[model samples]
Each structure stands twice: as structure tokens, then as C-alpha cells.
Target chain A: MRVLVAEDDRSSRMVTRRLLERLGHEVAVAEDGEEAWLQITSGEVFDVIISDWLMPRLDGHRLCQRIRRRENDHAVSYTYLILLTAMTDREHMLAGFEAGTDDFLSKPVDEAELVARLRVGERIMKLEQSLEAQVGELRTANEKLHADLQAAAMVQDSILPRNLPRDKRVSFGWEYLPCEQLAGDILNVIPINPDLYGVYLLDVSGHGVAAALKSVMISRVLSNDPLGSLLLGETPEESVTSPSRVLALLNERYPIDENSSDVSFFTIVYGLLDARKGTFRYANAGHPPVMVLRNGATELGKVGGPAIGMIDNWKFDEEEIQLDDSTRVYIYSDGIIENPNEEGEQFGYDRLAELIAGLGMCSTSRGATVVAGEARAWNPTEEIDDDVSVLVFGGDE
Target chain B: MSKSYPAIDQERLSAVSGGDREFEKELMEAFLEDAQLRVSQITEALQRQDTEALRSAAHTLKGAARNVGAAAIANVVMKIEEAASENELPGSDLLGEMTGEIARLVDQVRSSGT
Candidate 1:
């Protein structure tokens, strides 16, 4: 073991150094506390410090205190500080304890006793060093794990739609906020033809990764299915001619209890729009009611049928609306109207209707902006518990 | 009359030294230096609200104290580390007491003659 010897007395310092050397230990001599402090602070490594309690230019007590005050970056290395003191008074011992001395040897030190003390210091240091190394490794591993989780979050966000199609004949807008790194709400607008478009919005039953994965699965299914063919036709009237048929197909294929018997059903609103005819053929599967605004008048479209994937043969209600030249339609998930404030009062459909009615006086773009802004303001401090999504269509050319 | 100072426990010391006196010495010096450096690092970490660094410094100090047979100091260091890791400062009194203990230890070691 390498030892740091701090002392003012030349003879005592030499004797200590020779004794340590004879014990097969390397020794570094510090003439006083100040010198020892300097050596330690210089980033030199030592196994133990055998320091005298009294000396010129900083004493053993001060050195021990400084050593104790030193910060440790890695694992603990045992630096045993043995205070060489003549003071045997109980009060003096108490003072030594206060000064951070690990052990004490009275004046006219015995070689055997000194050697034994050094040996003890050596043993303790090794134990601490190993423990510290293990701890450092564990800490590093934890940091890496945290970093990996964050990277996964970024990948999840990348899968979400970035931009929506913008046209003068029809306007499209949406808002999405994930409760966590991933969410269950999925919305997409797919163009089937020049004059025909399919707008789909789905909300899974729960939140987090499981629900998010399901929503993604549903999105993939819709993207690859033959549903796009239904939107393509010469006349606007032919587009989405059967809203109930689409629901029936989905319900048959993706039964909720097939994978799990739990409540795995989802609320979906699928609409086929014809730009030329200014009309929409839509089906609502136990989802939130859609809102229609025509020339500053707002009306809630009725909820059509049971949620898809709930039962094997659930019938759906098809709805059609002829949009006026200045008409605007709003469709959304239940998260919006069902959001509750600190007072436990939900921002119910009634309140939503009022907001739409008030904002309907302006252009579709402005109205959508106002509604989103107001909803956020309602609960500025608290987090939105569920995913909030909004889609607005029909703007003047 | 021969002065019979307490006999140093060679076996315990060797065990603590991991059978490497040079390595033990190096480790001890490194720990002291690190502990000193950590004081400033702790201050910076606290100022910047770096909980990770604060926790790390406290943990290191605690371990080093135990190795050097400073059990009381180790206990205090452990408390500080726990508080810092949990992102709570605990109380000013505890911090003050720890600082006082460390300062006194440094003073004693400084005064001791080789």
C-alpha cells in the first residue's frame, strides 16, 4: 500500500516513512498539513495517510478535516488518517474525533502498534473501493436505460401524421396530444380519387402503448383494405353510397373478443366526401356526435350505431348531409367533450355546441382555431387525461 | 516503561487494502482528491439543479467514509446522498452538521505530525 505521511517533526516524519517502507508499502512525505492538502488536491492517489496530530503550517486535525471535506467522484478509496498525538485527555480524544481522525497513536509510538493500524486502514480501503466500483457501474447502466426509453419515445412520435392535405374547396384541420409517449387516437385523410376522399378517425378504448399499438394496427388495416374503392366513382352521389356496409365489413373482420374478451371495442367515425356535390356520407359507430354548421347555424348530427368490434352482427345507422357552400362540419373523438376540469364538470356536448355556435359566425378556419384555443384555456394548469382530436371540413373556395 | 499503543489490526487493514498496499494508498489518495473536488462539484450541481451529480457525489463520499473507518461521517454522507437522489434537500440543519463534521476532520488531519 502507498501511504501519505503528514508531519512537521523531521525525525518523526522520517521514522514513519522508514517504517512504512520496511512494511513493503510505498510512502509519500508531506512536511505539514498544508503540504499534505496540496498533494491530495493535486490528484495523486494514495492508499492511506499516517498523519501527526500537531505540526506547523496546518495540523493533523485540520488535514483530516480537509480530507473529510473532500468530495469523492468514483468509488471510495480508504485513506486511513492516524493522528500522532501526545494529548490523551478524554476531551482531547473527543476533539480528535470531531476533527475526523480515524485512529490515534500516542507520542513515542510503538512500531508494532503503528504497523497494525496501517494494516487495518489497508483492509478497510479495499472493501470500500470494490463497493464503490460496483455502484458506479450500476449508475452508468441506469443512465443508459433512461436514454434508451427517450429514444423510443421519439420513434413513436415519428409514426404520427405530419401534415394534412389543404384545398380551397375543402378545409382540413386536426389536433393531437398524447397523454404519454404513445397514444391510442389515430386520424388520417386518404384521397381515393380527384373528387373523392376518405376521412377516418378512431379512438381505442384505453391509453398508452397497448392502445397505441391497436390504433396503429387499425390504421394499417384501413390503409391496405379495399375501402378505398368505395370512395372512387364518377358522380359524388356514388362515393360512400353505403356507410353502413363499411361498418358491417369492419365489424365482421375485427371482432373485439377474438383476441381478448375484454372491452376492446373502439369508437370510429368514417366519412366519404364528394367535393363537387358538397355532400358527405358518414357512419358513426357509437362515437361522439358530429357537428354541422351552415351559415352561422350549428346542429349536432345524431350518433349512428353501436361501436365496431363490440358484437358480431351489430347494425349501423347511415347519415347523409348536403353541405351548403359555406357549411362546415366538425368530427372528433369523445376525449374532447368528456374532458373534466378540476371541479369535476365535464366539458359536455352542450358546452361544445355553444362554443361551435359562437365560433360558427366566422370562417371555418377561424372557428376551428377558436375552439382548440378555448379548450386548452379551460384547463391550462392540468394535463389533458385523454387524447383530444378535432377535424374540421368545408371552407369557402 | 514501554508505551503500549493500541496494536494496529494488520489482517483487517490488509483485507481493506485488498492485499495491495500500493493500490490501497493510491485508492486512498484518489478518494481524498475526489472528495475535495466533489465539494466544488456539489456546489455547481446544486446551483444548476443537477440532481444526478449531487446524488453521485454524496454516494461517493459515503462509500469513502466507510472505507476509512469514519462510520459517523459515512452515515451523514449516506443521508445527504439519499436526500439528493430523491431530489429533496431535507433540512438545512443536517447539511450544516455534516459540513461541520467534515471541516473538523480536515483540521485534525492537518494538525497531525508524521
Candidate 2:
């Protein structure tokens, strides 16, 4: 190890340097605290320092204070300081400890005691070095994970409905807010034909990467090529598959494994909208009710069984609604109504419907965005813990 | 001819010097020069009645004297330091005692040619 000896007296400095060198350590001599401070601040890292108590410019205690301050400010490596003090009183020892001296050596240092103290310093420095290395590695790993999540978020965003289908008779709008880097909520619109469109909003059971992966997989299947054939019928001549059958097909595909410990499931609202005819046929599988906006908000209540994947081979009921020119339909995830304020009161279903009804005849997109914002604002912290998704269509006027 | 001061521990000096005659001689010479410089500084401070300077110089000399195993000189300087620390001026008699101990240690170091 490299050691520094700071003594105003030449004889003591020479003696310390000689003793340290004899112990197979490289030694540097400083006439006083000022010289030692210069070498320390100028980027010469030393393992141990033996400093005299009283010196001209800077004293040993004050020098130790400055070293400790720099160590905290810049997070420099640790340097074990041994104050060479003749003041062995309890008061003086406490003062030296307050100044951050690691140990104390008498004015006439003992060679055996010096060797043992240096060994302790070496052990402490080695532990610090290894801990620093581990922290560096963990930081690198965390950064890589963050970058990967950002990339995944971007991919999920790309799959959403960027450009809604253009129709003077039917308009579509949606808002998706993810509380974390990855969200379990996903929604999309599938154009089955010129007259018909398939729309869906799905929320997996939980909120993070596991739930998000399942949502993404479901989204890929829903938006896969030949979606019209997949959703409507096996052939073009066959009639369109009802919303209930489509949901049943989905439930069968994502059934929960009874043998495994994971009982994960999802809730969804899938609908087939006849844009030309103003007819919406939808099935809700343990999801929040669909809000139909006319004079006031009306809820298309639950019609299906439990949430999809919870039970195998369960049958679901379908509901159909006839919308007029002034009707706007909204299907949303449970995150909107379940979000609680600071008072521990959830933004309930009634509050959500009243808030949307107050918007009156606003455009579908503006209404969706406003409701999403209001739901977020309901929480005092404004930190949503669940993924929020809202899909609106059928703005005929 | 070899000479020794009763207050100076020869064994302690030999241990510090690692039984090297040249190194022991070098240590004694360095201690002598530092002690002389500090002794004069103490004398001036005493003449001026500067308790702070007297305490500080005495402290330095005390440390160097202890390093050279001159306990008699170290003990005398320590008393001077303690007196000044208490804001009490060292009288002529105490000053004379400190100087006398320093002089004896210096003489013994010079006479003993390593």
C-alpha cells in the first residue's frame, strides 16, 4: 500500500517514512497538513495517511475534516487517516473522532501497532472496492432493462388504432393510458368489410410485464391477417359470427391452466358495428358496462359469464343496440372506474357516466380524451396504478 | 567513547532505528536540529509571554523529543505545554528546567558517535 506521512518535524517524518518503507509500503512525505492536502486534492490517491496533530497552515483534525468533506461531495475512495497525537485525554480523542480520523497513533508511533492498523485499513478498502464494482454492474443492468421496456412500449403504441376508419356516418375515437412502462390494456378496430367493423377492448388480470405480454399476444391474434375470415366466417358466403361466438372462440383459446399455479385471466368487450345501419352487437365478459350516450348515459349491463380464461367452455350472451345519429358508444377498461382518490373513494360507474353525459354532443375523440384525463385527475397523486383504456365509436351526427 | 542520558531510552532508539547505526545517527542529528529550532522559538515566546506560541512550540518539541526516546526532555516540554494551555505563563524556573533537560539530551546524542 501507498502511505503518506504528514509531520512538521523532519525527524518524525523521516522516522515514519522509514518505518513504512521498511514494512514494504511506498511512502510519501508531507511537511505539514497543507502539503498533504495539496497532494490529496491533486488526484494522488493514498491508502493510509499518518498526520501530525499540530502544524503551521492546517492542523491534522482540520485536514481530516476536509478529506471527509471531499469524500462525501465527490464520492471518492476511502482513505484511512491515523492522527499522530500525544493528547490521549478522552476529550481530545472524541474531538479526533469527530474530525473523522480512523485511528490514532501516539507521537512516537509503535511499529507493531502501525502494522496491525494498516492491515485493518487494507481489509476495509478491499471491501469498499468490491461493493463499488457490484453497484456499477447493477446500474448497467438496470439501464439495459429500462431501454428494453421503452422499446417494448413503443411497439405496443404502434399497434393501436392510428387512423380510424373514415366514414361520414360512423366515427371512432379512443384513449389509452398505461400506468407503467408496460400495460395490460389493449384495444383495436378491425375492418371486416365496408359495412361492418369489429372493435375490441381487452384488459388482462394484472398490470405489468406478464399481463402486457398476454395482452400483446391477444392483440396479435385479433389483428392477424384474414381477421374478417377469423371473426366473421370461414368463407365469404357465410354469415358474420355473432359477438358471443367470437368471444367464445377467444375464451376457448385463452383458457386458464388448471394444473399450473397461475390463474391469470382477462376481461373484454368485443362488438360488431354495422356503420351503415347504426346497429352495434356486443358481448361483455366480466368487463365494465358499455356506455351509450343519447339524452343521458345508459349502461349496457353485464351479459356474459365470468372474465375470459377463468373457466373453460363457458357460454356468453350477446346484446344488440340500435344507435341514432346523436348516439355515441363507449367501451372502457375497469381502471377508469376503479381508480381511487385520496379519500379512498373510487371514481365509480355512476360518476363516470354522469361526467360523460355532461359532455353532451362533443366529438367521440374529444370526449374519450376528456374522460381519460378526468379519471386521472380524480386521484390526488395523479399516479394511476392500473392501465386505462377507452374506445368510443358511433358519432353519427 | 559512548555516552548515554539517563532520561533517554537507548533500547527505544535502537528499536526505532532497526539496529542500523547510520540510521540511528541520522535520526539523532535530525532530532537535534528540530529540538534546537523549537527550543529557541519557545525561549522567544516565553520572553514575549505569548502563551499560544509557547504551547504550540512546546507541543512540537515534545513530540520530537519523545520520538528520539528522550523522555526527560519530553516530560519537561509537556509541562510547559500544559501550563500554556491553562493560559499560565511558564516562569523563569520552569523555562530553565525545560532548557536544561533539552541541553543534556543534545549533549548525550552528540557525544555518542554511532
Candidate 3:
């Protein structure tokens, strides 16, 4: 260890130096507190400083104060300060401690007691060094995790529907917001043919990476090849499969495994839209009701079955809605309506319907944006706690 | 003679010296020079009736005397320091007693051949 001896008297300085050197510690000597401060600031770090309390220039207490200030201001390595004094009263000891003295020794420092105190200082220094290193490592790990999550979020965003099919009979718009870095909510519009399109909005049981991974898998299964998916019939003629049959296929494929520890489930609304006829046939499996924005807002798809993966071979009933050019249809996750305000009241379906109706003759895109904005505004934090998603179709105005 | 002052404590001197003859000789020589200077400063301060200067000079000598195991000199200097710290100059008689204690310590150091 490196030791610095700051004493105004030459004989005491020599005695301390000899004792420390004998103990196998490197020794540096300063005639007074001022010189000691200079050595400390010269960039050579010392482990311990043995300073005499009374000196000519810059007394030991003031030196300790300055050293403590530098440690706080610049975050320098800690230096254990031991003050040498002839005054053994409790009052002087308290004053020395308040001045940042780590230990106190009498005028004639005993070698045994000095050695014990230095050992304690050495232990404290070692502990501090180790703690600093651990904190540095944790900081690095946290940064890496944040960067990785951002990259994953970007990948998820890229898979959303873009350059939506242009049909004069209908238009589409959507909003997606994830409360965390990863979310289980997914929505997409797949063009099965020139006349028919497949649309879906799904919410898996949980959040974060596990739920997101399942959503991604389901998305790939549904949208990878639209015409070849369960959305179409098996007969080589490529007939559009009924909404009820497609949901039945999904129910058969995904069932809650009794053996698996992490049992999972999902709520989804899948539909087939005939753009020429403006007929939407959809099946809801334990999802929120689909809203039709006609005169006011009417709820549909409530006549369906329980959530997927809950029961095997559960028959999901289908429902159809005839949409005019001026009518808009919305498919959304429960996160939108279930979000709570400051008073713990949910932003229910009634409020969502009213906000959409208030849009009057706006475009489907503007309607989607306004509905999402209203849901976010209803909450005091202006940030939804769950994954909020909305898909709007139709509304030629 | 049942004197009030004993020049040195051998046990303490041995402990501080760490069985090093050269270091012991060095400490004795350093104390000899520093003690004479501190005693003369105390004398001058007493003549001028300066208690602060007397306290400071006595404190310096007290530390050196204690380090070298000259307990008698340290004890005498400590009394002078305590009096001076209270803004009271020691009488010429107390200063004489301290001077005599330092002289006895110097004789002991010389006679012991260290």
C-alpha cells in the first residue's frame, strides 16, 4: 500500500516513515499539510494518509475537508485519513471525525494500533473498488438490453400492413401502441385476391417477449401465403374459405397443452371482406365486439365462441355486416376500451363509439387516428398500460 | 533522590526503535536538535509574555519528546502547553524546570551512546 506522512515536525515524520517502510508500505513525506495536498493532487493516488493535526500552513482538519470536497466534486478514489493528535479528549475526536478523519492516533503513534487501523482501511478500499467494477458491468448490460429491444421493436413495426390495397369501394387505416418494448397485439390486412381480402386483429394472453414471440408465429401462419392459408379452401380452385371455417382451423391447431407449464390463449377477430359487394363476414373468438360506424355505432361478432386454446373443437359462429361506402367498420383489442382513467373507470366501448361518430365525414385514416388519440387522452398519464390496437375499414367519405 | 522527572522509558524506546540501532540513533539526534530549538522559542516567548507562541513552541517539543520516549520532558512541556493554551504564560520557575528536564534527557541520550 502507498502511505503519505504529513507532519510539520521532522523527527515525527522520520519516525512514521521508518515504521511504515518497515511494514512493507511505500512511503511519501510532506513537511506540512500544504505539501501533502499538492502530492495528493499530483495524480499519484495514495491508499492512506497519516496527517498531524497541528501544522503551520493548512492544518490537518482543513486538509481533510479539502480532500473530502475533492472526492465528492471530482469522484476521486477514496483516501483513508488518520489524524495524529496529542489531545485525547472526546471533543477533539468528534471534531476530527467531522473533518473527515477515518481514524485517530495519539502524538506518539503505537506501531501495533497503526498497523490494525491500516488493515481496516485496506479492507474498505478493496470493497469500494469491487463495488465500482460491478456497477460498471451492470450499466453495460442494461444498455445492451435496451438496444436489442429497440431493434426487435423495429422488426415488429416493419411487418405491419403498408401500402394497403387500393379499392375504390373501401379503404383501411390502423393504429398500434405497445405499452412495453414487446407486445402480443398484432393486426394485418391480407389481400387474398383482387375481389377478396383477409383481415385479422389478435391479442395473445400476456405481454413481453414470450407473448410477442407467439404473436409473431401466429402472424406468419396467417399472412405468409394468404390464398394458401386456412383463409382459402383446399380445392385447387382457390375458393375463399368462410370466416367460421378459418377460425375452426386455428382452434384445432392451437390448444392449451395440459403438460406445458406455461398454458397460453388468445382472442382474435378474423374476417373476409368482399370489396365489390361491401360485405364483411367475420368470426370473433372471445374478442371485443366489432363496431360498425353507421348512424351511431352498432356492435357485431358477439355471437362467437370462447377464446382460442381454451377448449378443443369449439364451434365458433360467424356474423356478417353489409357496409355502405360511407360506413366504417372497426376491429380492435380490449386494451383500447379497457384502459382506465385517473378515477379507475375504464374507457369503455360507449366512449370509443361516441368519439368515432363525432368524426362525422372524415376519412378512415383520420377516424382511426382520432379514436386512438381519444383512448390515450382519457388516461391521466396519456400512455396506455396495455397494448392498444385498432383497424378501420371502409368510410369512403 | 525521588526526583519529579525521569528522562526516558526504555520499554517505550525499544518499541519505537523496532530493534534498529541506526534508526534509534537517528531519532535521538533529530530530537536533540528539535528540542533545543523548541526550548529556546519557549524562553523567548516567556520573555515577551506571548502565550500563543509559548503554547505552539511547547506543543512542538512535547510531540518530539513523546516520540523519543523522553516522558519527563514531554510531561513538563505538556504542563507549559496547557497553561499557555489558557492564555497564561508559564512562570520563569516552570520554564526552568522544563529546561532542566530537556538537559537531563540530552545527557541520557549521549551517555547511552545513541
Q: Could you tell me how far off, in angstroms, the CA of residue A375 lies in candidate 1 after the best superposition?
A: 1.9
Write model 1 residue lDDT over A228-325, tens digit each, in one string: 44333325555443567767777876677765644566888888777778788888888888888777677888757878887778888778878766
Number of clashing residue pairs, candidate 3: 0
CA lDDT of every candidate: 0.69, 0.83, 0.83
True contacts kept of 3: 0.57
On a 0 to 100 scale, what is the lDDT of residue A260 in model 1? Answer: 64
Screening candidate 2 with a backbone cut-off below 3 angstroms (N, C-alpha, C), the clashing residue pairs are none
lDDT of 3 by residue, A55-173 (tens): 98889999999999999999888888999998889999999999999998777878898889899988987987888788789989989977777776666677777767778878898
Weakest lDDT window of 10 consecutive positions for candidate 2 chain B? B1-10
Native contact fraction per model: 0.00, 0.60, 0.57
Off by over 4 Å in 3: A65-76, A85-101, A204-207, A210-214, A224-266, A303-314, A382-384, B1-5
Q: Which runs of model 2 end up more than 4 angstroms from their true locations?
A: A88-99, A227-242, A255-265, B1-5, B91-96
Model 3 alpha-carbon miss at residue B30, Å: 2.8
TM-score of chain A of each: 0.63, 0.87, 0.83
Candidate 2, B1-114: lDDT as tens digits:
012345678787777778887888888888888788898999899889999999989988888888878877788788899999999998777778877776776677677774
